[model samples]
Target: MYHYTAIQWIFFFYFYCFFGWCFESTYVSLKSRKLVNRGFCRGPFLPLYGSGAIMMLVVSMPFQDNLVLVYIAGCIGATVLEYVTGVTMEALFKVRYWDYSKNKFNFQGHICLGSSLAWGGLTILMTEFIHKPIEHLVLSIPDSILTPVTLVLTALIGADFALSFKAALDLRDVLE
Candidate 1:
């Protein structure tokens, strides 16, 4: 059976969250110019890394041996989540949060294959390779100490997301 330590699972959660934020920022930096010209606005919300990770976990539950499949699933799932979040946010805010659905690789308002692949690859690389090892390293610590630290880190991540969301709201002035 595929078993993971508590630390391992925690790392996966943080790792995916970090990747989501990174992907959103990276996409904005590299693609925003083009996206803007095309009439789409890059919303400030973090990309759906958590949702992707959750989806990946569920998919991987049934197929533990196939890492490749898991990675692929994570990438695709994350991309879809990101798109859905964007669409929902736009509807809630009455703004063009983003509009990749019309782009060449976009289908019905989501990113194209190119963007999706890039985000997915990065997420896999970070979560499977980088994050896993780091998690293991942290796990080697005594649990009594590690548990509290992990909780602190998770709280910090949540706070950071809140701040970023506020910043995104501020950016609305520019987008409008």
Candidate 2:
């Protein structure tokens, strides 16, 4: 199993969050014909992507040599994460961010087999081909540069969360 420093994991979390936001925003914009954040966070971060990526990384570490197992497990794990995220967001904010109602083999419009496989397949490719080099690059950064950058990002994310949470609460109250 691969073990990463806490700092490295932090780096991965933030990187994946922003990356997810970019991908999601672009895809949603293409579909809706307008720009959209496509993220739960007010900032350019997707917590779900952060969670999913790190979850798969840690989960796949144990099966480093077993590509097939990693693929299967990553798919199932991500799918479950997606479903839970959808349900939790709705339950908490009285909103559903995305619906898979029209997708085949979807459960409660939360998760579909097609998307699950796509996520899993992507996980496999990332874990096998991309993560190691990225991890190496992340680790190579001197602490002098890495620490301050990480600190700034954490502060910004915290501020965004606080403001967004307050707004969500106000909106929820209004809806109620």
Candidate 3:
């Protein structure tokens, strides 16, 4: 079991958010043959990824020794989060950021079997491979530096989310 300070957890979340954005943007840009900032926020962050990473960590805590259990837990947890997020975002913005309507075994275009299975694999990869180095790096940082950095990042991301939320609402009005 890994223990982290609140600041450390926050830092991990932000790091994963940026990482997710990079991965997503690159994939999207390659597919479209153009530069595309992929995420709800204008900044290089994806709240869904951050939240999913955190959820994976939390859900896999008890079953860390058993990869199969970890996979199951991740599938259930991530799918629920994805579904709820998709539903809420569509309701608020009048647009679907992701739609699995065409995918086989999708529920309300929000969650799908393939995505859920992939989430399970991602959870195992994250817990077994990705997090160790990140954990070490975060642990090495002194509180004096980490605290102030986290505070600044929190403020910046909060502002970005607020702006993005407002823009989404405005877009919803236009769509309506």
Best by TM-score: 3
CA lDDT of every candidate? 0.61, 0.86, 0.95
- Clashes in each model (backbone N, CA, C under 3 Å)? 2, 0, 0
lDDT of 1 by residue, 8-98 (tens): 5775566566556666667766776543211122322233555566555655555456667656766677677777777777754456656
Model 1: residue 153 alpha-carbon error in angstroms: 2.9
Residues 77-96, candidate 3, lDDT per residue (tens digit)? Answer: 99999999999999999999
Model 3 ranges with Cα > 4 A deviation: none
Q: Model 2 segments beyond 4 Å from truth?
A: none
| CA displacement after TM-score superposition, residue 163 of candidate 2 (Å) | 1.3
For model 1, the superposed segments whose C-alpha errors exceed 4 Å read 5-8, 19-47, 50-58, 94-102, 117-128, 160-176
> Clashing residue pairs, candidate 3?
none
- For all predicted structures, in order, the TM-scores are 0.58, 0.92, 0.98
Candidate 1 lDDT (Cα, 0 to 1): 0.61
Model 2 residue 167 CA deviation (Å) reads 1.5
